[model samples]
Target: MALNIKIHKADNRGKADYGWLKARYSFSFANYFDPLRERFGVLRVLNDDIIDGGGGFDTHPHNNMEIITIPLKGALEHRDSMGNSSVIREGEIQYMSAGIGVQHSERNFSDSEPINLLQLWIFPKTKNTKPLYDQINLEGKRIQNSIQTIVSPEGGKDIIKINQDAWLSLLNSDAGLKHKYELHKPDNGLFVFVIEGETVIGANIARHRDSVEIKGVEEITLTINAPSKLLLIEVPED
Candidate 1:
C-alpha cells in the first residue's frame, strides 16, 4: 500500500482560552468540536495546554480511556482516587488507566510559574480492566538526534506501559540531522507532533506545534532543519 500523509497545522487546531488556562486540541475535546478532526485511529485526544500558576483541572471522572500526560515546561501535581499522587515535570511522563472509572485532579505545582503539558487519550484494546497510575522520568533515557521510545505496550527498561498496542517516542534532533523510523507493528499509523523547531517529513515542512499523520507506511524519514523536539506516536490504523 502507498503511504498517505496528512498535515495538521498548529494554528488550525481547536482552541480554548480561559482566564487561567489556554489549550489547543488536536482532536475533538470539550467544547471544541470538528467532525473531520475527531480522531486518527485509536489515538483519540492530543491536547497542548498551558496552565497559569496555581490553576488546573479539578477532580474529574474518567472511564475506559488510557490517559498519558507529558509535561513540557513546568510542573503539574497529580492526585487520583487510587491514592497516586506525584509531581510530574519536564522530562517526565505520567500514565493513568481509567479502566472502569477513576477520579483525578491536576494542578500547577508551582505558585509562580505556569505549566505547559501535553495530554493524550488513547482507546484501550480491552475495556473495564483496572485503574492504574504510574510515571517515568525520561531525563537520561532520551537519545539525542534519534527517536527514543518513552511509552509502549510492552514496558521495558525506561519505558512506560499502557493498555493499548501503541508506542510513543520522543526525538530531539540538531539542525541538519536525519533519521528514519520503522513501524513497530504492521498496519500501524504514525503521528508526528513537532513540539519545537522545524523539520521536514518527505515534502511537508512542519514547524513548532505542527503535526503530521502518516498511514500505510512501513518507514518514514525525518529531516531536521533546525534544533527540534518531536513526539512520534504509533497506533493501530483501525
Candidate 2:
C-alpha cells in the first residue's frame, strides 16, 4: 500500500480572534472557508481554541454530528439541552452525540484562568437516533509512553463512544520513544496532530500544532523528537 501523506503546517491554519475567544481551524469552518480543506475523510471540524476567563459560546444547535472536546489547559463547563451538565478539565475528554438535534454551550470553568481546548466534529454513520453525552478523566488511566485509546465506536469502560466507525487516541511519549500506530479499519485514514513538542515520521517532521494526514496505508511509525503529546484520529476515507 502506498502511503499518501500530506502535512498541514501550524501556521497555515485559518485564524479567527474575538474578544473572548481565539481559534485556529484545521478545516473550513464558520466564516473561514477553504475549498480544499472543507473536510478530511469523515472528520469535519478540528478547532484549537483558547477561551478567556469567564467567556464561552451560548447554546447552539447541531444534528447528525459526533462532537468531542478535550480540555488541554483548564476546565470547561458544558451544558446541553439533554439535561447534561459537567465540567471537563485537563486530563478529561467529553463527547456529545447530536443525533437528531441538540443545543449546548461550553464556557470557561474559571473566572480568572484562561482555557485551551481542542474540539472535533465528525460525520456520524447512524443519525437521527438519540442525543447523548459522555465524559472521562484520563489522569490515572493513561499509560505513559503508549497510545491510549480515548474514543472509539464502542463505548467501553474507558473509551467514549462516537456514532461512527472512528477512533481517537492520545500518546504522551518521552523523547526518543519510538511508536507504531496501525489503523483499526483498513480503509480508514489517520490524522496525526502534535499537541506539544516534536515528532518525526519518516522524512516528515511535525511540531506544536502541526498535523499529518496519511491514508492508503495500514500503519505508520513515529519517533518522538521531544517529550511530546500527540493526538491520533482515524476515520473513513469517504
lDDT by residue for model 2 (14-69), tens: 99999899999999988899999988899999999999999999998999999999
lDDT (0-100) at residue 234 of candidate 2? 96
Q: In candidate 2, which residue ranges exceed 4 Å CA deviation?
A: none
TM-score (C-alpha) between model 1 and the true structure:
0.98
TM-scores for all predictions: 0.98, 0.98
Candidate 1 structure lDDT: 0.94
Which runs of model 1 end up more than 4 angstroms from their true locations? none
User: Tens-digit lDDT track for model 1 on 1-238?
Assistant: 6879989999999999998999999999999999999998899999999999989999999999999999999999999999998999999999999999999999999988999999999999899989999899988777898789988998988888889989999999999989999999888999999999999998999999999999988899999999999999999988
User: Candidate 1: how large is its RMSD?
Assistant: 0.8
C-alpha RMSD values across all candidates: 0.8, 0.9
| Alpha-carbon shift of residue 161 in model 2 (angstroms) | 1.5
